[model samples]
Target: MEVLIRPDADDAARTVAGIVHQALAEGVRTLGLATGSAPVGVYRELARRHRHEGLGFAGVDAFLLDEYVGLPPAHPQSLAEVIRRELAEHVDLDPARLHLPSGTAPDLFAEARRFERCLTEAGPLGLQILGIGVNGHIGFNEPGSSLASRTRLKTLTDDTRRDNARFFGSIDDVPRHVITQGLATIGEASHLVLIATGPHKARAVAAAVEGPLTATCPASVLQLHPHATVVVDELAASRLEQQAYYRCIARHKPARHRY
Candidate 1:
């Protein structure tokens, strides 16, 4: 995994946005998107580029990473609605081309199979964006999730619910279950870019970028990917042991691999 530390969240977001923009220009039309504070800035920057730099996503086929089970699609806190409000609405992406798991399906197991099939049919994602949980979970794949798991229904842990509580009225309002793309499924993307910010993410970032490959830190699976990039603000990179080495690598990155 390549770790790029920026001075701050905005700088980090800009770097990620540039990677996405460049990919689009090079004929990448499929994207796997994540929701949460970490990626909000990246989405905002992309929106800005769409408005000012003529960046277009007209033919893009986007897939959401996960969604809360039992929540209505129109729910303000739903991942689908969150993505729409944050990025889709501002760009030229077609609603019909944006896919998300059916969170309210009567048969969630069947829904999981259907969504997995949809993802497979779309072919490999050009890029998959991710946000690490305070506990190092990716998507709704909580601690102890099988590294080889696939798209499926997962029960949310208390820590995750509490962390997401700020988005709803209270922890009680947060859904206890979610349908997420598993680690194995996420690993299929051609490129994986994970964004993390703030001091709260420092330890998790370190564990993911430098720690052992273990299910305890689900994000650590990035280490096994052929093309994975972890972009973080200085605060988030604080706990990483090889910060200097990562910086050196970034500084000497070859021109063809600049992004």
Candidate 2:
């Protein structure tokens, strides 16, 4: 695992965007993505790349990590709509290649199952983009989430609902249940890029990078990944007593200067 601490969020976002483009250039046609403030920078960077660098996703397929169960896919707060407005609509990626859990499906478990099968056919994902929850959750995999879990619907913790309440008008509007890929599902990706930012994530970030690979704090599972990169801003990495060690492993290569 490698950790890259940037001066701030935007710098970290640009760095993540470069990493996304690098993965794409390496012939990765399928991307597993996440929805959260942490990965918004990566999506923004991808938008810029498409607008200015001719970065194309013509052959790329995208699979979202999770979505609220009760929310309509058409809802603006829905992860599907967010991706459409934030990234997909602005890019050249084929709509047919965009895959998401069907919130409208009568049988959500079946929807999740079918989606998992799509993943098997489309993947193992070339790159899986992630966000570290303040509570050390990943893709709605909350505290006590099993390490070898599979795709399924899960109940969101009060803290997660409160954190996500900012996106909705109120906490009441946040769905308690969600369909998310299990820790095992995310772990199957060939490469993992976990993005986290802000002081809010300090303790969790510290636990993930420096702590043991345990299920108590789900993100700590990254410690077991062979090709995982944990990208954060300084504030998030603040609790890491061994900052220099992580820094030395993540020396940056400027996107502009790389070619």
Candidate 3:
């Protein structure tokens, strides 16, 4: 695991965008994408590069990490719509190349299995982008989720529901379930880059990066990944005991090494 600490969110975004750009330059085609405020800056930076620097996503295929189970595809708060509004529509990537699990399928469990099969057939993702939740959840694989679990429908915890309520206008409007890739599925990616910001995420970040590898903190699975990178602002890195060590390592890492 590699951790990079930046002064603020924008700097962290720039660092991550640089890594993504380098990955594309090296001919990486399959990407795992994430949504939410934490990654908005990274998307904005990438979009800027697309608009001004001619960086293109036309050749890339993207898979979303998860989706709210009961939300309509057209719903404003739906993960699909959020991705479109935030990243996909802003890039040159083909709309058909963006893959999303069907959260609204009549047979949701079957849909999840189908999605998992398709993902496996496609092989390992070149790069998987992630956003750590304040509660240490990743892609809705909440506390108590099995480390070897696969893609499936998962119940949302009250804490998670409350955290997401603002996006849905009210707590009551939040979906009770979601379809998410499990830790095992995420671990199959060739690379995992998690971006986090704000002091609110400090404790969870510490728990994920420095604490024991346990399902109680789903993000802790990153520690088990062969190639995992955690990019966070100083505020979010606050609780990390090895902050100085991480900073020094990042500073001394070879330029040839991305992230």
User: Which parts of model 2 have CA positions greater than 4 angstroms off?
Assistant: 252-259
Deviation from truth (RMSD, Å), model 3: 1.0
- Estimate, for each residue in 154-221, the C-alpha lDDT of model 1 and write its tens digit: 99999999999999979999999999999999999999999999999999999998899999999999
User: Model 2 over residues 1-259: C-alpha lDDT tens digits?
Assistant: 7788888999888878888898888799999989899787789889989999999999899999999888788899999998888899889989989999976679989988888898888869999999988899999999999999888888999999999999997999999999999999999999889888999999999998888888879998888888898888999989998998766655554554231
Query: Candidates 1 and 2: which is better by lDDT?
Result: 1
Cα lDDT tens digits for candidate 3, 36-100? 88777898999998999888898798999999988888899889888888889899989999999
> Residue-pair clashes per candidate, as listed?
0, 0, 0
Off by over 4 Å in 3: none
Error of 2 at 27 (Å): 0.6
Stretches > 4 Å off in candidate 1: none
